[model samples]
Target: DIDRKHIHIVSVRVDETGKKISDSFEKKRSDAIRKELEKKYSLLPAEKQRQPENLPLKRVDYKAGDVKKQVSNVAKVVMKSYRFQSLNEYRAVLSIYGVTVEEVKGEVRGKAYNGLVYSALDRKGEKVGNPFKASLIGKTAGYDALQKRIAFSKQSMKEKAVYNRSRNIISTLLANKPDRKVFEKELAKNGISVLFRENDDKRIYGVTFIDHQEKTVFNGSRLGKEFSANVFHELFNRNGRQDSSGIDYEKQFHINNQDYQPEQESTAEAIAGIFSMEQHGDDYEELAFTNRMKRRKKKRKGFGL
Candidate 1:
């Protein structure tokens, strides 16, 4: 219905008891996205256009308890700065900003819709207050916009080619049988944050890596199966004789050359067993024979023949 000066809109939600839900979802979502802009950008009532891209956005303070604005600021900065292909990957990065997002899909009054809900998290990783609809922020933070961003991020990550650097750092650490605390410390030193998602039984089910240097977030499996949660859990749980892939990370990727390498038998030894891991430290006689041969050569040279 239309009024003389303004139009009114109404909606409702009913609970299982057939009573109204009385949630103020619409009012909160309808709060203009321009509120943040006006407060920070000094926009006057006369300004019609949004801020330009060249202008920098003021970072929001998560401690201020402004969930909506905080979520919006984090989403904008992440969408512009980082490369993530999946919701989990995106959430891992947003989590650093004290925010999280969920994808929602359902039917209402015979209409089906898919959308995202944004929420703010506290220092302890608890939701602070009511969540906000994607619409409350803007199209930039909407579901569709994020899907496009994911695709573009995929391409951008490929072009950057920095994943290997992140991987080598992680693999080098894991290969040495480091504990969880040491693993995290080494990664942090290399500008990487690995978030492990675990369950009630303390079983690690998922993992995400955020590379601060490259500004990229990657799911564990996306990096490779070797970096998956299973690999990490096994490394910390089991004796760590071998990583999840059953390859000794230390020997396979021996970065420290001072570590001894097995002395080889004659070059004509069995070809099929070349990759064997056996090391022969009991060959004292062979070393003695080599020393004798060297001395014989020295004595021959001393003769000046």
Candidate 2:
């Protein structure tokens, strides 16, 4: 949230050609000044993202009705196209393709084994048919292969600063742009797409990033705690809210009331009465409302005197 009315002075340019203007190495000097200003103001740097070659432009289509084939295509493509750590992270990207995966753990011949099964999803995002075993699709999408892929991805990503670049871009977008749609659009320009999983209430429970430049799909929590889904939900859902995750609003309300002199005995009660309160999250507002109503009625008795 930024003030729409404020003039956020980013840069000032002067071009008085009459006196002090010089054309010698002007381009080089201007570039240096731009870098210095960006560093000083912590502004977003110049674009460095480049789309990779041989990447698939289309995603899986769920309406085609071939569950096994559709799941197979996206499963293999996602397994090769993205770099994800855990199985859950892998499945998050798959969801956008109308697919889901699960791990079946068991023992065979006194040895532990883990296997992957992919299922197709319907328009409602529910699994519609029998799940396809990893072997049925290919070994590349299997449990063992994915384990190796995860390790290889970690080693490769650790050697590059792509993670840092993503974090910087996402952080700046979130702070500067308040709207989620705009945030997503800006990210798209940087070769990144976000997948948010929300419950029926539309509160985001999980977040995944598909960075086309880096050819990686990973969960936001893997990037850092700050990029977690809860953080984004709190940010996008609230207004002028400093701390939504950990705040005892009831206690704060009591403290504020006790610290200030009451102009009207029923101040809290009158305010609560004007606004209908419902059961939300912790319902701290409900408690505050009831207490205010009680105090207001008590003060009315004093008016009778």
Query: Judged by TM-score, which candidate is best?
Result: 1
Scanning candidate 2 in windows of ten residues, the lowest lDDT window is: 270-279
Point out the worst 10-residue segment of candidate 1 by lDDT.
266-275
Candidate 2 lDDT by residue in tens digits, 1-305:
11123344344344655465566897799778878988999877644422332234223355555556667767776777678777756766666555778888899999998998888765345676687898988887799988988887778777547587778889888778465655655665565657665544655666778665566767787778989877887887776432222322122112122211112332222111111111123333235545765898989988983
Q: List the residue pairs that clash in candidate 2.
A: 266-296
Alpha-carbon runs more than 4 Å astray in model 2: 1-57, 62-65, 197-205, 240-305
Residues 183-237, candidate 1, lDDT per residue (tens digit)? 6656654656677765445556567787766767886777788987778768777
| Candidate 1 RMSD to the real structure | 21.5
Error of 2 at 238 (Å): 1.4
Per-residue lDDT for 20 in model 1?
85
